[model samples]
Target: MSAEIAEQPAAARRTLERLMPQRESLRELAQGRRRVLLAARGSSDNAAIYGRYLLEVVAEVPTALAAPSVATHYQANLDLSDTVVVSVSQSGSTAEIVQTQQWARACGAATVAITNVDGSPLAQSADVALVTQAGPEVAVPATKTYLTQMVALGVLADALSSGEALAGDLDQVPDAVSRLLQVDVAAAAEALAVADQVVVSGRGLLLGTALETALKMEETCLRPVRGYSYADLRHGPISVVSEGLLAVLVAAAHGPLAEPMADLVRDLHARGARVLGIGGTPTFAELCDLHLPGPDLSEAVEPIASIVPAQLMIEQMARRLGLDPDNPRGLSKVTQTEFAG
Candidate 1:
């Protein structure tokens, strides 16, 4: 897992280089698309969350996260002719995801499959495939594949939007991720070593990061971690904040949303919860009992970089708890649901 994490910089660079030649085709597909829909499960779904933010904000295209069961179970025959449906899966063989892509293609939508496997069902089913060159991810808990998926989504957003600024930001992601991977988070891991539960919260794009982090911790460390957006946390969940609870807040420093995140951190701290801030301005650092090193990038692009530290923390926590992250109990590398393609 560590080696796979370290390879992300090169993996991202290679993915961008490989996708460059296909940019024109992707742009052509995006030309008249009325909306974008993404489908996936587990960590891939988290990547889709980041993609939703990118397509809406960067490409200025309305985007929705698809509920595959609507098509697979309920048999909804909605028209998707003017939509671009993207199916994300590491193995590319996930039944629901493949079924979603197939259904989208059947509806005359331009379908794209983002996967690591080249000849998987999803790749064959889509009109175009954006394969993540992360290589063989042997771990049951996806590390490199998740990061590479985000990078692939960024490349796709860049292709669709034709934004030079976003293109440059994508180029810097590899280095920023590398720098984040090198940060020493041993202290933070040790701090949370004894905690049985944690609350991971973030705003905007990092909300996906929070979800992914909580998932990783639960899968690897056998800990109960619940993730929530700050707004959702404040809606009612803040009542759970108490002396024994550990809250990890992932926020972006250079955005309008930063102030609210900082305020939440302060609120959590005042509520007798130990707040661990992942990103924000100096005020956030001051309010947080502990702060993890985070990438200094726009919130849209920061998800790719910010998630690295959280993954590292989970890996460290798994090691400290004497659990095998590569092969977590009761989980497989590729889950085969009853709905096969």
Candidate 2:
């Protein structure tokens, strides 16, 4: 890691402490019997998927993750009734998500923003702004910022459902995140390099994480990767299972699908596919390797912890493929739509 990333945890810790949404704000939203609607795009959208899961399961509230355009363009489906709209963005200036937040507020929803930028427009527009302490995201592809977004979102969910008791635990997350990055993800990378095809599978909250992981692999490793639900993986995705195939599983902290997921891993291994488990206390088969460890967070929050290993794996995979992760082809840090006049 460079000096830049080496100090990310400290900066993130400060941001988490200083700029998180006030507990009172979140408690008020939860106490009011409101649902949550998460609006975002790209990786921020993916983070909202996990956040939605946390809100539903932990907070015991109804939640949804909507594409920003869905609210901005498809207004008919938008619901503002007793709803808390959370707009997540790294820049807090993305045109689509920011516009969606405006629409939500105009429609009478309590608006919150989780962003890296402190006083950017989206944050300023929100009724409650939660700043992720990720500092500046220099990489064209998001890494730490996405992780901290989840941290901020997850805490907000806890506060929304369980109150200060649950939200207070967020203070320990920076230390946990720092320790997670210390794991050697090289093993997973080594396994990925030789494989011809890869499938990433998960359930519940981690299912969205599985999708994000697949997208990252596609973006960084330039490989054919797909995300699937644990049960769904057994249907048609297993047809490709073979000696050269790799199946990566994201088994999260707590969920009803854990045992079935374990069965899928075992079945995949039996069919000659290499299995790699990424979760807490993975039980990989004799032929498989596991990359596991991090704080015991809910399944919704495990993806945040898992992102460190995922990035390391991709970094090494990109290096092996003779591609610079710092600069991927046909991609740029910021993208503006054509003819925006």
Q: Judged by TM-score, which candidate is best?
A: 1
Please give the TM-score that candidate 2 achieves against the real structure.
0.88
For residues 224-335, what per-residue lDDT tens digits would candidate 2 score against the true structure? 8988877687688678778888888877545676556667767887888877877634443333455555456644555666666676677777888887776677666555
Model 2, which residues run further than 4 Å from truth? 1-8, 19-21, 29-33, 77-79, 253-255, 282-287, 290-300, 336-341
What TM-score does structure 1 among the candidates reach?
Answer: 0.96
Q: What's the CA RMSD of model 2 in angstroms?
A: 2.7
Which lDDT values do the candidates have, in the order given?
0.84, 0.73
lDDT of 1 by residue, 1-341 (tens): 77787888888888877776777778787667788899999999888988998888887788999998887888678889899999999999988788888888878789988999999999887888998888888788998899889988888887778455377788888889888988888877877777645899887777788889888888888888898877888899998788888898888877777777777877887888888778778888888888887898776799898988888888887899898878888888777667356
**RMSD, candidate 1, Å:** 1.6
The C-alpha TM-scores of every prediction are 0.96, 0.88
